[model samples]
Target chain A: AQSVTQPDIHITVSEGASLELRCNYSYGATPYLFWYVQSPGQGLQLLLKYFSGDTLVQGIKGFEAEFKRSQSSFNLRKPSVHWSDAAEYFCASKGNTDKLIFGTGTRLQVFP
Target chain B: EPEVTQTPSHQVTQMGQEVILRCVPISNHLYFYWYRQILGQKVEFLVSFYNNEISEKSEIFDDQFSVERPDGSNFTLKIRSTKLEDSAMYFCASSANSGSYNEQFFGPGTRLTVL
Candidate 1:
């Protein structure tokens, strides 16, 4: 079955530190991958998405993700973390239909 | 900027009662979707709608669950009989089109609590 995996459940980073969250996906065809962030009491916000072409995609809030086909991974990265960036991050892939299959999210906690 | 909007930020209902969650998707979008996140769980897709009909649905969308675009502006999800397990944050989303490149804009979800 097609699925997205987020190996990390929780991650902590001091403010201004570099951050990376891992994601892997299993799909039969070239997949459409996405990264979304959900803050407490807020909706899921799209950070970035990779459909085709360039391996690295830039998204809002200084977030970026690289799609590595060989590794079947699309991991999110940020050069410097902010207190506001602390939220639950989810990795997802569009299924054959319009639905998105999401991984168990990784919660990021930022310390000042 | 245009954004999806949902009514009633939170709803509390007794088990076995019916509840309707309403949403207004981006005005020009053709596709609408409903997803839910149980507390401490991944967001799960429940159903997708387009052109006044359901285009796709997940296993979790059982007979009791139904979606409707009642008019031009409102999309609603109705649970015939709510269960305790139905407690979740229900989200409504829409994209300009169904294309792979179209980003789905999400709305602040409606939190449904069943007792």
Candidate 2:
């Protein structure tokens, strides 16, 4: 079974500071990785995805993630954090069966 | 851009009652999925539908739960004899196809509260 692990349960960053959320996955083959964000009372929004080719994938809201196959990691990063970026972020990986398994998620808190 | 939409933004039902959550997937999407997030937990896939049949389902999707695309655009999940454990945010997602490159678009989600 494919699974995702987000080591950080919560992350805090100051406005304009850099942010990085860790994600790791366990799958037999090359996995389809994705990052999603959910604001309070809103639906989950896709940040970005990685299927093949380039190791670094860019996403909406100035967020990006790098798929490190050797590390089994797809960590999300933002150069500068904004207050609006505070939300729950989830990392997911699609298995060969095409089912997306999600990580426990990291709740980001941005302070001024 | 087209997006998925779910109905009954919030539904509160009594235990043992049946509840149906509806969704209108993207007009051109061919694959539909249902997922749920229990409070403070990760979202778990329940079932995936394509060609009007279930293609994949997780153990979380048991006999008490069923999915149907009764019409052209509507995809619905029905839970029979709901339990308090069923309380969670139920989300509907759709993808253009099963291709690995395609991404699934998620709906706002329906908050189901079983009392």
Among these predicted structures, which one has the highest DockQ? 2
Across B1-115, the per-residue lDDT of candidate 2 in tens digits comes to: 8989999999999999999999999999999999999999999999999998999999989999999999998999999999999999999999998967868999999999999
Interface RMSD of each: 1.1, 1.0
lDDT of 1 by residue, A50-106 (tens): 999999999999999999999999999999999999999999998557789999999
Clashing pairs in 2: none
lDDT score at residue A47, model 1, on the 0-100 scale:
95
- Model 1 segments beyond 4 Å from truth? none
* TM-score of the first chain alone, every candidate: 0.98, 0.98
State the lDDT of candidate 2 residue by residue for A37-56, as single tens digits: 99999899999999999999
Q: Lowest summed lDDT over 10 consecutive residues: which window, candidate 1 chain B?
A: B96-105
For candidate 2, the docking band is high
Predicted candidate 2: what Cα RMSD to the true structure?
Answer: 0.7
